[model samples]
Target: MAEDLVLDTAIRDWVLIPLSVVMVLIGILRYFVSKLMRSSPAPDAKMVKEGQVIIRARNLKSGANFIPPRSFRTRRLYYSNEENGLLHVPKGQGTNPQAQMFSDPNMAMDMMKKNLSMIIPQTLTFGFVNFFFSGFVAAKIPFPLTQRFRSMLQNGIDLSTVDVSYVSSRSWYFLNLFGLRGLFSLILGDENAIDDTQRMMQMGGLGFDASKSLSAEKDGLDIIQHEWALPRFEQRAESVLRKLVK
Candidate 1:
């Protein structure tokens, strides 16, 4: 077994603390930059109507048992009706996403701004860490970690013999980048733009497909076997009342 390296206190002071502080400061800077660059486009009326229809369908599906059978059936029919229903999008009627993006220059601009805000600072920070603190063992984790954690925690360090608990400065930067989400949330509130993970997920996800979403909600509403619960509740209430009287 490879012995653990004794990390210097100066390494923690100069590399670990400064790197973490830089990451936090960068996150704050990114949040404000994104806020300044964000554009609020007027929502399309049809899109708003479609979104509300989906919300109503979802509510109906979740609360189907609570409402009367007649009301449930009526609500389901309003959305899932084969003809003239809110959720029924005609075949071949879905808008091409590329075309939509092309048609709206403001949307494209907003996307560009978001990308710039996310990418530029990250690239700069990464370069700064690599240039200054590369291969420096910054700190050691308190708990034992498996060998699988080597690549994750020891980034920029080429030494395969080093234990996984020793975190390199570059990896420390990344750890602070992702791990400070809760700290950023506490400082900047829950909805702040400091979360890189959320931004990455948003970048990966397909933007809202209205037709597909509506179709899915319609299918979900159609399959639900709603049973009214009021009668069961009434019986239970009567039983409780009788017990109280006795």
Candidate 2:
């Protein structure tokens, strides 16, 4: 059996405390910088209307069973009608996202700004930690962790004998990077740009296709089998009333 290593208390005070504090401060700074760099362009009215139409269509599909058959059919027809439906995207109305980005200078600039804000700070922070605190054992977690957690928690340290619960400076930095999201959300609002995970996911995702969304919503509305529940509810209410009377 391997013996547990006793870590010096000063490591926590010098390396762990400062690293965490600096990470938090950097996150707050990044949030403010992102906010300042964000450009607020006036939204297109047609795009807004299209988004609302999709929302209304989705709501109708979700609550179809609750509404009367006549009302449900009317709402469904309003969205799914072949000739004049709101969800119908006319031919040639959809523009390629790449072309749209090329045509709109502001869109390209905004994307560049977002990329810069996410990348620059991350690079600088990683460099800073690597230069100053590389290979140092920052802190040991209170509970025992399995060997599977060794690669994740003990990133900078290469020794096989080290306990899996012991966190290296590099691993601690990563932990703080992802773990501060809730804290950032509390200090800034929910929509704040301090979250790196969301930024990465946004970079990975396909940009929204309005025409595709409208077509999908239309398809969803068409397939729903709307059965009015009022009569059933009334019957259940009568049964309950009869039991109460008995």
Candidate 3:
């Protein structure tokens, strides 16, 4: 194993400071790129009505217990009646459950735009770091790392004797890429032009077919166990009275 060597302060001036600055700038740029790429969805009257109806029915199922049974029956009849049930689909109304979701073009378009945003910055950064910041140990964390991270944290330099904790310039940039998010948020407000946390989360769900999301949501809604909240009022009052007396 190579002996440990102290890194110069010049590395801080030339590598660490510069890499940190550039990453923050790049994150802010990507934020705007994503903002410009995002297009607002068009309003769909039918879809809006469908959502409202579904919510109304679900709320009634779990919450309408306090309505007199006759009134509840009437309301349920209004929802379940063969002519105009809220939950029932009309014969020709987008019969394929996933049809609407699959046909929507916005998610695909947004995904492409976001991918471009991520790719451009990453590619540019790789080339930039290799060109200008190669062959120097940039920074070290407070803790130790194993041999596994040595290769990852030192891209251009190759030396068995070098400590794994001493990262190369490019490695420092990559580390700052993911690590300085909190600092970025502090510099640029929580919902500002530099935040990509939400964007990254959106990326995770991007692989899922939009249709599957709709199907999953429907499955979830279908199995909701509706326990009425009002039936235990009399027992509750007695218990409260007993507590007061005690």
lDDT per residue as tens, model 1, 86-157: 999999998876678778887778788788888898899899989988889898888889999999999888
Better of 2 and 3 by lDDT: 2
Task: Please give the CA lDDT of all the candidate structures.
Answer: 0.85, 0.85, 0.69
Which candidate achieves the best TM-score against the true structure?
1
Tens digits of per-residue lDDT for model 3 on 82-149? 56655544455544534544576775676677777777778997898788888888876667888998
Report residue 63 deviation for candidate 3 (angstroms): 4.5
Give the higher-TM-score candidate: 1 or 2: 1
Error of 1 at 112 (Å): 1.4
Candidate 1 local distance difference test against the native: 0.85
